[model samples]
Each structure stands twice: as structure tokens, then as C-alpha cells.
Target: MKFAIFGVGGTGGVIGGYLANAGNDVTFLARGAHLKAMQEKGLTIHTNHRGDIHIEPCKAVSADDYHETPDVLFICVKYYSLEAAIELTRRIAGPDTLVIPILNVFGTGAVMQEKLPDKTVLDGCIYVFAKRSGPGVIEQPQEILRVFYGFRPGQDSRLAEKAAELEKIMRAADIHAHFTDDIQRDALTKFSFVSPMGAACLYFGVTSEAFQENKEVRETFIGLVKEVEALGHAMGVTFDRDLVATDLRLMDAFAPGLTTSMQRDVAAGGPSEFSGLVSRIVTLGKKYHVPTPLYKKIDDWCKAHGLA
Candidate 1:
């Protein structure tokens, strides 16, 4: 299938590179040093799952330079970059095109629907960490990356069938894929786990393992999850109490060296999704009359550290 990938950063670069290598017609939308390198050399992906894979002489162009409409458009831009990405999607979107946004925010599917009313818009979640180690080079955190997707509420069967077909296609490409019945819950579930870990780690400047090594810090870490869990439930996203318990267990297994990408971004002074994660939890807690002292505390700490 023909594909257009917007914002070909670390995550986008990895996925797009794989599909391109698998012989799919993939066009990457990028600019600056990364784009220059992709154009000059090619996209290089280093992963623990698949080892080193490179896509040299790959197809790429700026958003404005793209001329061919794609069957599928993968919106992989950061949350802050969504508005511009949408405008660019419009430039290349056709009547039957499908838009898949891989993001952490909850309401993005709805936003995409509002903007691309005629197109099939789906919600997608990705489980992988990647960084642009160099121009056109990605350092993948895992050997295999996984993607889950589903149609938004009130959408039709064609999108579902399309998602199923895509899953099969991804598996063929050696990229794991699954169809989720409820994408909203999946998104929130991830948020419930990741946001708290990120907040706690960023607040303390330590990995989850190190954060949990100290008794008091570990307790604070769990408190962050509890507070976010309360807010998530109040927002109509039900999470099992046992899930929070599982988070703690996983943290213990992951150790104090395990840090969220958000924490890493904060330490590097890069733009982070703090507002979408912790800030949203704290704001929604107030709206739902839920107590979020832990989030408030960490939010304050992040602001003080100039990480917010």
C-alpha cells in the first residue's frame, strides 16, 4: 500500500523505514538535518529486536512538496505539532484516504475526525521508545515494536476491516500489530501507567528503579499512580485497583534505572508532553472533584526545575 508518514522523527522513522524495506511505497515528510540526511544517505534504524536495518535512497519530501495522495497516512508528529500536521494531511488526503494518528493524547481521534470528516480516522497506540541518535538514524529501545489500533466510536465497518488488513500487512512487514476493541481505554490505560512514572521520575531526576530504591521515593511513586488513577476513573476510564499494584511490581522489576522517555526529554530540555500527561491529570482531577495531591506535588516540582 502507498503510505505517507508525517513527522518522521524517531518513531516515524523506524516504522516507515521498516515498511519501506518491506517494499511498500513509503513517503516520509520531514525537514532540517534529519531530512537532509535521509535524502543524502538514507534512514538507518538500529534496534535490539531486528538488529541494524537501513533504508537508503528512501522517498521523502517536505509536507508542501508531496504530490501523491496516499492510501494511508500515518500522523506521527508530537502532540504540539498536530495542528500543522493536520493541515499537511489535507494537502495529500483523498476521499478514500485513512488517517492514523499515533499519539498519547486521549481526544486526538475526535480532533482528527472533526478535521477530516470524509476520511477514515483511527486511533493508534505504539509501544516502543526511539530517539534520533543522528540525522536519519534511529536508536530503537526494543527489538520489536508493537502497534494497536481501532476505529473511533460511531465509525463504520470499513475502517475496522481496514485496520484488520493493516495488522496483517504489518505482521508481514515483521512489525507486530493488533486490533483493539476499545482504543480510548487503551490510550488511557497507557497514560495511567506512563504519565505517573514520567512525573515521578522527572520530579526526582532519577529512573523508576532508582526512584523506587528509596523507600520514601517508592511510596511517592505509587502515590502518583494512585492520584492519576483516581482522576482517570473520575473521567469515566475505569482501571482496576490491581493494575496500580501491578505498576509497582513492574517498577520493582524494571528497577530504578528505568526511566520514561518523558523524563529523558525533560532532562535534555526538549519539548515534552507534560501538559497532555500530568497537567491534564491534575486539571481533570479538579474538574471531577478528585484529589490529586501527588500530581500537584510533582507538577510543582517539574515547574520549579524548569522542566514544565
Candidate 2:
């Protein structure tokens, strides 16, 4: 499949690097120094699982420069960048193009679908500890790379076959891609881990090790996860496992000193995903009549700190 990766950060960089390294047709949409580096020196991925990959002669361009319609377009930008991505999609994506958003914020694809009613936007999530260490360079700190995507319940299935084929292609590139049957539950399952972690880490101004050792931090994390679980249940999601326990297990398994992107962005004194990852939960809690006291507390803290 001809692939277009929008926002070639850590997640998109790894995905596009692997696919292109596997001899698949891939075009990366990036800008500034990253785009310049990829255009001149090509894209490089540093990974423990795959040693390292360098895709020279890489096809990298900004969204404004890209004119070809691709078979699949992966929206990998930050939540705050979704409006620009949507505009790019509106201008470039054809009717037959498949759009998949593998963002940390849950329900992103559905949000995009609402904006692009004519396109096929599949809800997707990825599990990987990756970041762009430099221009045209991506670092995967861990080997845990998994992707799940599927159409939302009661949505159109006209592109189901194409989604399945894309799954095969991704797996062939060594991605643990699953064309899941229930994206709502699966996406929320991933969200159950990320939202709470981001909330606790940003709220307390700590790293991954704090959640492991600090009793107060750990309890806060657990509380946030339970709130997400409650909201999910209220939204008619049937989770297969205990979300708090599962998230705690994942939290304990994290590498020490690790921090979420939101934490990093806020620490850098820039725009972060506080609205999507943290504030969104509080909003949903009110919408679903679920109590999210922990998230509300954190959201209030962010507002007071001028971080929201």
C-alpha cells in the first residue's frame, strides 16, 4: 500500500521507517528541521528490537508539498495539531483514502470522522515508548510496539477489507497490528493507561519512578484509572479486565525516570495535551454522569498553575 505518514514524530517515524525499510511505498509529511534532515540525510530509527534502521532516499515533504493521494494516511500529530491535520486531509485525501489516527488521546478518529464525514477514519491506538531524539532521528526506548485499529460500532464497513489488508501489511513490517472487532473498548483500554499516567505525572511533577515508589502518587494514579473505568462503563464499554490492576501492572513495568509527552511538553513550557488527556476526562465525566474527582482535581490544578 502507498502510505502517507502525517506528523513524523516518534510514533509516525517508527511506523513509516519500518514500512519503508520493508520496501513498502511510504511518504512522510513533516516540516522544519525534521523535514530538511529527512530530505537531505534520510530518516533513521534507533531501536533495540531491530538494531537500527536507516531509510535513505526517503520521500519526505511537508503537507503543503504533498500532492499524491495515498492508500492509507496515518495521522500521528499531537492532539493540539489535529485541526491542521484535518485541514490537510480535507485538501489531499481522496474519497478512497483510509485515515487512521494513532494518537494517545482516545476517540480521536471518531472526532476526525465527524469533521470529515466522507472519509473512512478508523480509530486506532499504539503502545510504544518512542520519541524523536533529533532531527530525522527517532528513538524507541523499548521494544513494545503494538497497534490496534478498527471501525467503530454501527459505522460503515465498506472499507473493512482494506483495513484488514493494511493490518497484514503492518504485521509484515513487524508491527503487532490488530484489526480489532471492538475499537471503542480497545481504544479506551489503551486510554485507561495513558490518561491516568499523564494526569498523575503532570499533577505531581514527577517521573515514572514516583508512581512505583511513592504511596501517594501510586494511589493517585490508581484513582485516576478507576475514574476512567467508571466513565468507560457508563459509556457502554464492556472492558474484559480490571482497568486499575492492568494499568498498575503496566505502570510498574515502565522504565525508571520515564516521563510522558505531556509532562515533557509542560516542563518545556509549551502547549501540551492537557486538554485532551486530562481535561477531556473531566468533560466526559460530566457528559456521562460519572464521578471523576481525581481527574477534576488534577484539571483544577492545571488551571490554577496556568498549564491548561
Candidate 3:
């Protein structure tokens, strides 16, 4: 499959590199030092579970130079970069293009569809511990990286066939890929973990391990999940399992220094997923009349400090 990865940071770099290494046609849309590095050398992936990977002779170009369309496109940039990414996607996304945005923010698929109505957009998320260690280098820890995606129910789009083909290609590259029957619920369920963890950790100025050690922090984490769940329910999304308890179990098993990308971005004084994760919760809470005290506290802090 001809794949275009717009924003080859951590998640995109790892997934796109794997496909390119598997001899598939993959093009990376990047900028700055990262683009230069990938064009000069290649994309590199460092992992703890799997051995290191280096994919040379990879195709990469900046937005101003790329014009060819692809069979599939993955928008892996942060929420703040979505506008620019969407414009770039338009330059390469034709009728046959299936755009899947692998982001931490819920409702990203809907947002993208609203912006680019002509393209096929699907809901998707990634479960992995990863980050861009440098311009051309990406890193993943814990050896766990899986992708979940599917079309929204009642939307008969031809991209479903392309999704199946994409799954086969991904698994061929040894990446776990699953097509969910209910993509909205899956996005919300996935958000229940990362969003709450980020709000809790950043608000309390601690790590995942610290949340487990402190009772107040633990309660706040659970509270944040409840808030998000209530908002999801208000939006007519059904969460079948005990997501809060499940997320707590995840917290228990978290590595010693595990922290959300939002936390790291905030610490580095860069743009973060705060607006989509924490501030979105608070906004939805108010819209649905759900009391989101936990997220509200974090939101206030974010505003006071200009973190968002």
C-alpha cells in the first residue's frame, strides 16, 4: 500500500519506519532537523522489547515540496498541528485516500472530517510508550505498541477495504493492529487512561508511580476518569467495562518513571495535548452538566500558568 505519514515524530516515525523497512511504499512528511536527518540518513527506531531498527533510503519531503497523493495517510501530529497537517493532507489526499489520525485527543476523526469533508477519515488510537529521542530517531519502551481503528457505525465507506489491507501490511511488519467494531467507544476508552493520567500527573507535579503512592492523587485520577466517562455517556457513547478500575490497574503496572507526553511537553514549555485532553474534559463537563472538579482544578492551573 502507498502510505503517507504526515508528522514523523515518535508514533509516526516508528510505524512508518516499520512499513518502509518491510519494503512497502511509505513517504514521510516532516520538517526542520527531523526532515533533514531522514532525507540525509533515514528514520531510526529504538526499542527495548524489539531490537533497534534503521530504515535508510526512505522517502521524505516537506509540505511545500510534496504533491503526490497516497493510498493511505496517517496524521500523527499533535492537536495544535492539526490545522497545518490538514492543509498538507489536502495537497495529497484525493478521493481514494484513507486518512487515519492517530492522536491522543478524542473526537479527532470527527474534527478532521469536518475540516476535510471529501476524504475518508476514521477513528484510531495507539497504545505505546514512545517518544522522538532526536530529529531522526524514535524510541519505544515496554515493547507494547498496538493500533485500534475502525469506521463509525452506519457509515458505509469504501475505505473499510483499505483498512483491512492496511492491517495486513502492519501485522506483516510485526505491529499489532486491530479494527474495532465501535471506534468512538474505543477512542473514549483509550482516552480514559492517558488523559486522566496526564491531568493527574501534571496537576500534582508527579509521575505515574507517584500517583499510585499517594491516596489523594489516586482518587483524583479516578475522579478524572469518572468525569470523562460521564461526558462520554452524555454524548451517547457506551463504555462496556470498568475503565477507571482498568486504568488504575494499568497505573499499578506502569514503569517507574512512566509519564504522559502531555506532562513532558508541559515541562519542556512546548505546546501539549492539554487543550484536547484536560481542557476538553472540562469543556465537555460544563456542556453536559457533569461535575468535573478534578479536571477543573487542573484546567484552572493550566490557565493560570499559560500551559494551555
When sorted by lDDT, best at the front, the candidate numbers are 2, 3, 1
Alpha-carbon RMSD, each predicted model:
2.5, 1.0, 1.5
TM-score of each: 0.89, 0.98, 0.95
Clashing pairs in 3: none
Superior candidate under lDDT, 1 versus 2 = 2
Give the Cα-based TM-score of candidate 3 against the true structure.
Answer: 0.95
Tell me the spans in candidate 1 whose CA falls farther than 4 Å from its real position.
238-242, 245-259, 268-270
1 or 2, greater by TM-score: 2
lDDT of each: 0.77, 0.92, 0.86
- Top lDDT hit: 2
- Model 3 residue 72 CA deviation (Å) reads 0.9
Q: Highest TM-score: which candidate?
A: 2
**Candidate 2 lDDT tens digits, 1-308:** 89999989889999999899999999999999999999999999998776989999999998999999999999999999999989988988887888999999999998999999988888999988889989999998788889999999888989889999999999999999999999999999999999999999888999899999999999999888889989999999999999988888888888888889998888889889899999999999999999998999999988998988
**How far is 90's C-alpha from truth in model 3 (Å)?**
1.6
lDDT, residue 194, model 1: 66
lDDT of 3: 0.86
